[model samples]
Target: MTDDAVPDLRASDADRERVAEILRDALAEGRLDMAEFEERLDATYQARTYGELAPITRDLPAGNGVAVPPVSLHKEPAPTEGWAGRIVGGEGSSTGAVAVMSGFQRKGRWTVPRKFTCFAFWGGGEIDLREADFADREVEINCIAIMGGMEVIVPPGVEVVVRGVGIMGGFDHREEGVPGDPGAPRVVVTGFAFWGGVGVERKETWAQRQRLKEERQRLKEERRREKLEREAGRRELDGSRHDLLGDLHGRHDPHRERRRGDTA
Candidate 1:
């Protein structure tokens, strides 16, 4: 049958398996969270026709086309490059920021010093490290805020240690202790806040996240091809065995008839 004619046909076990693989890839790439993945996975197995299976992964990258590919659950995540390039080990491009009654931001492709300090009084400041290089393996950021606020943003796969003290104020340390990438710098956040707040957040760069999604899709396609090859091999082996057995029976039957006739 033509490829275009198969959608209305009853979905086989293989069809359901393909859809399930696409869902698995989506979940791994963070396109879908656990709860959404579970719901779609259940629906995929319950689907009875190609039309039903097609919609399960229709919106996902893996299922953008008509075909749904298989993905290896055991595959390891792709590694980000070593941190040597990110650690310049020199003077910081900009040492710190101060906002007495305004706002200051230190971001972009700047160098972060080994010991960086920032203070905000009746104002606010922002420190972003998503694309910044580190001056040392271990960097300390000291922040002092009195009746003002500050925010620190770090990317995924970086160690963060928050040791800020807040008196009648708030210091965020929710992302502490998360494992970091190999050779990535360790960030120590130390600060004091009085009637003010300091917030720490973790985020991934948009480009990095997109690369991960594409990698997952590629792996899924490879696994699907492997599965199809395996199934084809099994079918060919079964056909050969059947033919061998039939040939043996045909040769024995003629001899048995001759023996019976001679005895009679």
Candidate 2:
């Protein structure tokens, strides 16, 4: 979307926090008085749309910069994670996870089903899909947290929708409306949170990062070895040239035959 389209878009908690940070900076710098800061802080939390948040810090520098963001909201660039390749159609490796006064984790190289469910009671669970294959392009993850918490982690490029109810708790919708890659999977998070929270985050996989690191190291080592070999080859060529020049000038002399013929 264009810059003009941003104002009408729904604002995430991150947007609100950005504005709040600017207001706090203004207060610390004496640009705003205590009363003004208090009023603006309250309004910042109540803001729901980008348009509503635009005016809060209209006169102040954003994130303590002359050139700031969200003061002029821009559409974030989407990353390509080769979502089409990850969408392997078949049965999921596993379906669900449960935690009762304990914790559970669903991560690593697994397949996510179309409708996977999880529950937590006085406990917590983690559903990490960074390295997961998908049973379908669109999948649903249902979570039920009671007096506990559940965290769902998805890689970037995936679209997320949170339709869960939270009473005295919350379901994180920060990653919503961020847009997905063309062939990326759409994950719908639904269910109930009673005195608990379900948090959704977009993060790069540790496995991917580690693999990249190792590849870089391998390339570096390969280059170093090639450089050493080239230097050694050059030294050997120089030594052979020196030996040939010494033989021509010293030990194997053609002048000795000429001298013998003159004597005869």
Candidate 3:
């Protein structure tokens, strides 16, 4: 005789539709994960009375149910002070000028280097752009790196877009060459980053232009072996004849031994 004085049973509509069928059987046995089943189905539609719907109807599932807890997502690295633009859903957003390098700590694993310059346009989550570095001029990154590694230095035309897979065990956008001035300002790296390592040098293709033409033919054969050992010490200080067949057989064998002893 202590259940709220056990004397007032006035719930209608078939007992509020049997407590909304036990919160839809605790959201179909999964026990709710769709954002807590939409916040307990919007608090059971803004419950007005009945002690505010009796603790979401006694946390439902008194019988057949129980199971739901698996939501892991981690890919951090987006915060600057001077000029980091457009990092959606998570935070940090700038428009025009920026140049920041905020404070982040991590010594055990070693982390601290976001000296400003990040620009992400559209992403659902998960992004770690390998400490992010986009020299800055204009940018638009997408999806974000689930593991990390993203670097973009825009200036030419200033347009870049990486769609997926920026997972980095190492490298991304690490650029250096591209400044011989061909009417600069025109760069655009697009999508599907399913891995890492992409250094853009005028839109490299043909196997990265045959591996940069075999690394510029091995640096022009090491500058032609240092210009033939500095031209063999400037051709031994101009004695000039460095055995070109012993100076052409020492002047043609003394004119062929005086014409073979005057034709004998």
Best of the candidates, lDDT: 2
Q: For each candidate, how many residue pairs have backbone atoms clashing (under 3 Å)?
A: 0, 0, 17
State each model's CA lDDT, in order: 0.79, 0.80, 0.37
lDDT of 2 by residue, 1-264 (tens): 576776666555567667767876676577987678768766666555667677888888775453223444455422234677899989898888899999999999999999899999999999999999999999999999999999999986588999999998899999999766567899999999999999999876685456445644664575578679989999999999999998787655778778877999
The global Cα lDDT (0 to 1) of model 3 is: 0.37
Candidate 1 structure quality by residue, lDDT tens digits, 81-109: 55678998989987888999999999888
- Model 2: worst 10 consecutive residues (lDDT sum): 71-80
- lDDT (tens digit, per residue) of candidate 3 on 33-55: 54565465445443323344556
Rank ordering of all candidates by TM-score, starting from the highest:
1, 2, 3
**Reference-based TM-score, model 1:** 0.54
TM-score of every candidate: 0.54, 0.51, 0.18
| Candidate 2 local distance difference test against the native | 0.80
Better of 1 and 3 by lDDT: 1
Lowest summed lDDT window (length 10), candidate 1: 70-79
With a 3 Å backbone cut-off (N, CA, C), the pairs that clash in candidate 2 are: none
